[model samples]
Target: MSDRIVESCRMCESSDLESVLDLGSTPPSDNFLTLEQLNKSETYYPLRLVCCKSCGLSQLSYVVDRETLFNPDYPYESGTSKFFRDHFEEMAASVTGKLNLAADDLAIDVGSNVGILTAAFQRNGVRSLGVEPVGRLAEKANMAGAETVHAFFDPDIGQKVRDSHGAASVITATNVFAHIDDLNAFVETIKILLKPTGVFVSESPYLLDLVQNLEYDTIYHEHLSYYSVAPMRSFFDRHGMEIIDVHPVDMHGGSLRTYVAFKGAHEVSESVGRYLANEKEQRLQDPEALKKFGAKAAAHKAELFEFLYELKREGKRIVGIGAPAKGNTFLNYCNIGPEILECLTEKAEAKVGLFAPGTHIPVLGDDFLENEQPDFGLLLSWNLKNEIMNNLSAFSAAGGKFIIPIPNIEII
Candidate 1:
């Protein structure tokens, strides 16, 4: 890949962007390859991190276009994980009661994968609509009774939504705010699509948690920015919005449920100030923090590969569990592939027979694990450890050991 250079910050547009960490090159996560495509060529892009000196938003310097990165085959669905499904339902009730959304008013969800939250909103008597980029997921969401538009959200789409359904009373985006490249255009559209007194609620993986846990594998082409409360205050203020509330949610490692509204439309919560102060004390936005992250990542990579090598030397049969996107980053960055593990198993039928993009490791189904019963399992989706452990109790009963790759490599 040729060098795709970005001189300025994505959020603040300041030329004083500083390089912090680099994860080398990686293929688009979620780009699981078909059998025929595997024998063909695959592209990789630079995975790097840089910080905005002006606004403190950390982001990837080399950006892959949204259309190519979010290609039609993106296979994530919110309903896959029981945690997200239940969490969304709770969020729907909380926000509905907090904002007092009526049956006649609209709730608009952006990047609404499989419309899990949108459906939740509808179930609670609030009418809901979704804007999704992937066609297949959108189609499935519509089939499942969630009104969704198969297109990316932009200012033009916002206006069309307004013309068709009127301004939305509540705007929600979950896990998609960090993936947007053009921050300016997106917030402008949100401003246009929101009712004067409406609230915009969003959730994103917290930067402090990523650093604390050394969760560097979350860095990928799709995630353009890493956010903290310190930066968001200024970013929203510049776009004619105010940060009203910040609630730390423990899922996805750790994430922030941020509430925003037009400037002065809502009272600024004391929680926002507390988070800003906490970020400073924790050094969440400092350039030196990622240097520590880079060091921890390097150590983890070496330790994990050493463990795998020892297992291979002992002739232990190994396979992977849950073909999560984070697994691709860890596997590819550590140079582990088909030779290191026989195959990776996942529950998703769509990914079962396919292969991970860059590493080209085969993804298998439940029956494969039941029959093969490998000597060891690599818990790639370590974040889902508790639920996965319960699901794979049979493997453990059969004397199969599982290795969890995270803040530390551990065998259980």
Candidate 2:
């Protein structure tokens, strides 16, 4: 046991929680180290995914500090995945059109990783700004021509933005709402920052996908909570916001893109009711569902390890494809390293010369796939499996197989 630090639910702050699953001790999923740092005694913390019975919110008991998680040098560039950029472009067009955005409308995106979506809004002559705590990312967003504030979007910062920019017409946080530790303050800030009639959109990995697909790897330090429609609906109601719509997005494997505004700003969309009904039918609010899902996740872990070990026994060399944050979680949780995987390949130059966070597996450029073709390549960014398979055709032409773990362990 890694000396228990204070653990409480972000939603209810109820210390009365039950452990749904324990991934054991692991390093921060995104803490990719330089070669020198790799040699040091890497720090590992206990990673336990717990649930608040009072609030029905799933979270990690061990929380890493914001500064350590959101470093100035944090290297997750959303634009690296062309699929992600194109997906956001489509979303920007749809949301802007649906909200009847004008050229002068100001939109703010919280934790705008590299400002890819903000730039999409800019292309339409709309004034857009991004609030990012990571200096390098915020600066990059500014250089890309989207005004970005290099600070965390807390209630204080939200008030400042509201005072200066005058309530945002559209405020969005994509794949970041779940990481917020202070859910109450965060939602309160959203209420303070948006106009009375403005729309606030948030997208996060849906708990349904996490459970059904056994995507336990997505449970990491930065992500403090896994949200569902039931709990979030109750949460937003408490904060005086109504979920106007919920769009199911295919991005991030499966995600829920929720749109909200001041209570009674617009009639709640039928989509919200449908999703909530679906949650109830699926028993999403029950703790037993999560516990069952945890068992399924453990079975998945065992199956993946067995399949890889069998391949190794048959003298088949294995290499990894796409070094993503979740890839780190999967690799570290599954205890995969050089023994199971020869090297992890990545497209991003920032991580190309680095190593996997805790496993210390060497990350190399995609050139290795062509020069040293392995028998099978474990698709780490399996969420973007189709795009990766298209990009690495040469590897396949040389008789290579791509292994996708989530949903199920399979060779595709």
Best by TM-score: 1
Q: How far does residue 42 in candidate 2 sit from its true spot (Å)?
A: 2.0
lDDT of each: 0.88, 0.86
For candidate 2, lDDT tens digit of each residue in 1-412?
A: 1233546767766787888888888888888889899768877887887878877778888777878888766888989988998988988888899899998798898999789989998886678889999999888888988888999888899889888888889998999999888788888888888888999998999988888878888888888888888778777887888889998899787999999888988888889889988887887767777888888877888889889999999999999998888888888878788899999999999888888888888999999999988899999898999999999999998899999988877887
Candidate 2 residue 57 Cα shift, in angstroms, is 1.2
| Candidate 1 vs. true structure, TM-score | 0.97
| Candidate 1 lDDT by residue in tens digits, 29-99 | 88999999988988899898888877888998898888887778887777887878899999999999999
- On lDDT, the leading prediction is 1
C-alpha lDDT (0 to 100) for residue 233 of candidate 2: 77
lDDT, model 1, position 370:
79
lDDT of 1: 0.88
